[model samples]
Target: MKAVIINTSTDSELVSADVVELSNEFNTFAQKTAESILAMGLTVAKAKRLSASDFETFCKLIRYESDSSAIRKLEQIGKRYDALHRHVDKLPSAWTTIYRLCTLDDSAIDASAASGALNPTIKGSDLIALCGAAKSSRGAKNAKSTTARAPADSAVPNGTDMVVRFTTTIDETQIVTLRRVCKLLREVDAEIALSNKLDAVLNQAVEMKEAA
Candidate 1:
């Protein structure tokens, strides 16, 4: 008679293997869902048949109801799809990174692609840094005009502090980008506050004069 062999693996070991398999399956499903959503959003935007209200209603019917801001970003990505399609395979899986890519002009996008910065393996933070670098380069090009207008724009009445306040909503991606900007401003000794509230002390003129 053939000997019966007992399973050597413990129950915990079997469970661990199942967990890893489940995680991989979940990740695959999530990636596919993200791709599908983007494709649907692009189609809707390209069609241009839906009004703002109509889009919201459609989203409800599809159970894809996202906030207006997020919907807007998705639409923007769709609008820029022509310039982006070539790099689709290399683009990061995260929709946030794709949105950030939309923020860049075609030329910058091309440059980033040429530099291999748009690799699928690139992190969202790395993409943000690339966007920041592109923005800084553009800012440098316009620095002279910006500096020329700064004095009048920043003037304040004597013996009184000037505080400008405004409110707007931002997403997680924007928050990360803002934090990076705040860090750079701090490094330049710019008087800026970053918390639940943001306050700018308008010390740019001082910094410019000092630099000159």
Candidate 2:
């Protein structure tokens, strides 16, 4: 059909390179970041991906912001959707959730639709915006930004003892609320229970590193 042709044309240039190679770069970034973020005990559970277009979501999370102010600021930057966030309990901060939404994008609508199917418009920063925008992107909206970044040491010295590495396994609303209060994760907090998970990943990483 004509729509299919348009879908093919959208990319202008299809991904000439292997998708796996493209993913490798992201995987490398994730693993390396794990080392630094994990030091803060900001593992996968407490941390979550955030969506960009949900300005309301960003602002609400920002209002209740905490130690990692940089993350709030990073939300302002742009990238493609499905950018995964390595969320920790109150360490790497909250809005890192937005980052998760950045790296994981999957929107494929009909090309015949007037809104335009197949996300070819997404490229560069605009692409990033798509990731963020996609969060609420009901009509194939891509709201998360998944651009790989090597953030400078935001780790607090001796932070490990004070906090255990944990990722967000907490259930939060897909939509953010305004005038929300930020909750700081206390040492060995029972609610954000990630001690077990953290122990698991750490040992696995060590073994892998040793094997490597």
Candidate 3:
């Protein structure tokens, strides 16, 4: 295949051998990075000469912002390097797509790519949806027992106004805090309902001035 280069700065197109050379350079760099990250992860995991528990100290010594962030970067590189380089080599700079793909196992990612579950454009949400759907389908297949429930009575209780149910996503950290908050609220005042607290917060927000 002929190599093509679109020079945005020069307003000229070079279509010959530069494209292939550029692709080769990119692949080499990506492979090196992936290998280095894999080595770093191994080093972190097996710290013979370093303290494993003090991640913050280790990060500072290595010039990283945080240990967790560095570890996640390593994970992303290690998981998606082969797939990204082999299938989506044209867009070597698409870190977002690579990171999204890191959420799934190699088999799930390969299946999604091969089955057209992944869009050509590869939006983050699309990858998330594909991974989630795959996980749900697997869970359904592995489920051994099923429970069937009858439709509940729609009538409200004598003292209650109504019942509300909804679905939403919450971050892991936030959900932990929410559970703690609920537990504390129950322990402090069993009669004070969650709806009451929600209403109170809403009213307070309505009456308060915006933060300057």
Candidate 4:
């Protein structure tokens, strides 16, 4: 990990003397996931980790660009242009992470349909809609639809699981790669966040100095 220090007194923009690169966030990522994965008594191979890109890629794989027709299908309503291109503010929507995690690309999306260790049937869209707006106004009007095959699973339009299954096959290498990718992504994200905050503070200090 590396860090940077900003010198407010000079025209020089970034003062690197005090900078520190943080490698521990990755460790934190490992720690958090380790706690969860290990608590379940599951194997803690390197493949269990996830990269941010991996997450994003998986998300992109499962997510569909919302159009009017798709929105209508989700909302279970007639085609209404007003329902197009809405936002869902959620961490891990049920339609993707939860759905994929449990079903691993199966036909059993509904909790009622399967008996597994993970029952993540909560509607991600429902939760996202509630974040900053009223449900009736924010969310797609129709019931949530499975936009694409959940992540790792194939498009089994009809299978035992609704989406993907926990039994989904991921080799040891993939799991380790996932863990490393996620850990690095988290570190990068945190560094970016910290950099932004530091920039803001430096700018504020500069402004105050000028005012003085």
- For candidate 2, the per-residue lDDT at 118 reads 17
In Å, residue 178's CA in model 3 sits off its true spot by: 24
Q: Which of the predicted structures, 1 or 4, would earn the higher TM-score when compared with the native? A: 1
TM value for model 3: 0.37
Off by over 4 Å in 1: 1-38, 144-212
Residue pairs of candidate 3 with colliding backbone atoms: none
> What tens digits encode model 3's per-residue C-alpha lDDT throughout 6-84?
4555476554343334333333434334243344443443332333434433443344555466555654554455664
Per-prediction RMSD in angstroms?
Answer: 20.9, 26.2, 18.4, 27.2
lDDT (Cα atoms) of all candidates against the true structure: 0.62, 0.34, 0.53, 0.35
Which candidate comes out best when scored by lDDT?
Answer: 1
Error of 4 at 185 (Å): 0.8
**TM-score against native, each model:** 0.49, 0.18, 0.37, 0.26
Off by over 4 Å in 2: 1-41, 44-66, 71-126, 132-136, 139-212
lDDT of 2: 0.34
Writing each residue's lDDT as its tens digit, candidate 1 over 19-118 gives: 2332233234334334543564465464334445544444443345546665667678778877777677677777777888887889888888888887
Between candidates 1 and 3, the one scoring higher on TM-score is 1
TM-score of 2: 0.18
lDDT digits (tens) for residues 20-64 of candidate 4: 111222223233221222211121111123343332322222232
